[model samples]
Target: MFHTILSQLVGTAIALFARVVTAVRGVWQGVEPVPRQRVYFANHTSNGDFVLIWTVLPPALRARTRPVAAADYWLTGKLKTFIGREVFNSVLIDRNPQTRREDPIVQMVTALDDGASLILFPEGTRNMTDQTLLPFKPGLYHLAQKRPDVEIVPTWIDNLTSVMPKGKIIPVPLLCSVTFGAPLEVIEGEDKAKFLARAEAALAALAQEVAR
Candidate 1:
């Protein structure tokens, strides 16, 4: 369809632009990016985090990766809604605690059930500093439990916090790097807290590695 073509075109353009703007360096620590279902979870620090992550992925893999974003933000305007839904193939969810028509967990589970890999920020919101990450929510734990076969890849992005700081409007060009660490394993009979702690540690370790 026209929309699908347009989406791919726009996505490709943005990904190209991101490469030049951020000077992104993608480092996959000995892990090959296989063509299969995966959950790409990372530390969120800026609005551009997902785009940068998508840009680092190979073109073929990028087509299958969808970022999980907030519906309230992406659905606010017509252009954003179109780009989020069509271009990025984002999985939008309602984050408002007061009003909710659908469960975010179920929605994400449905996306996996349909065979689409995801890019998720387990922190749920942007952290003030790239060095420190917020405590992860329980969503990742639940998702991992649901899809035992799907690999959950822990990613660490450096310098994005400085590129687009929390409250800044103009972005600064920086040498940002995206490091895809080893796949996270869910041990048998692991509880939510323990799994979340392990996931956080895995991501933190990658961040420290990237800092070096």
Candidate 2:
């Protein structure tokens, strides 16, 4: 009980700090901040991408949403482990197929079944290159196939890569924005390649919109 309370306090502090540092704004373009189960898939550029999304959400929705993060990174240190498991209530999945004990899709589907919305990065890993977006992995398609009823939203986070670069410990003060685009669903009989293509296009288009 004490740990739970401490976790909440830490989570609050983190969110507040993120807002103050980035001046993050939430822009709902094609959707409203309504209560519904959703998978928010965004471009992967920085590790703090999910935190910006979480911070901009309404408190009610924030309580029900969890970020999907890497197990290896989040479990390495004591503070990271506590924040990942307790504060953020993240869905940590092993990225290594050789050492993983469970399927990533199954873990995500289970989380959705339990009524928690997710913030996912279809890129599977952080984008450290010059590309606008890395080719998406098939995990997003599989999760959509398992739960077609859940809405999949395209989220575009702007200017975060500049705020906190790859290996920077302290973040720079910058204005950032989280844009939520229209929801997407896997068209009936859509092949994996096509669905992933459409999902990627949706996110890229949202980013372009934000760039305007």
lDDT of each: 0.89, 0.93
Tens-digit lDDT string for candidate 1 (5-64): 898899888888778779898888946877889898999988899999899898888888
Task: Give every collision pair in model 2.
Answer: none
CA error at residue 148 for candidate 2, angstroms:
0.6
Best by TM-score: 2
- The runs of at least 3 residues in candidate 2 whose Cα sits more than 4 Å from the true structure, single-residue gaps closed, are none
Model 2, 64-159: lDDT tens digits are 999999999999999999999999999999999999998889999999999999999999999999878999999989888889999999999999
TM-score of each: 0.96, 0.98
On lDDT, the candidate that comes out on top is 2
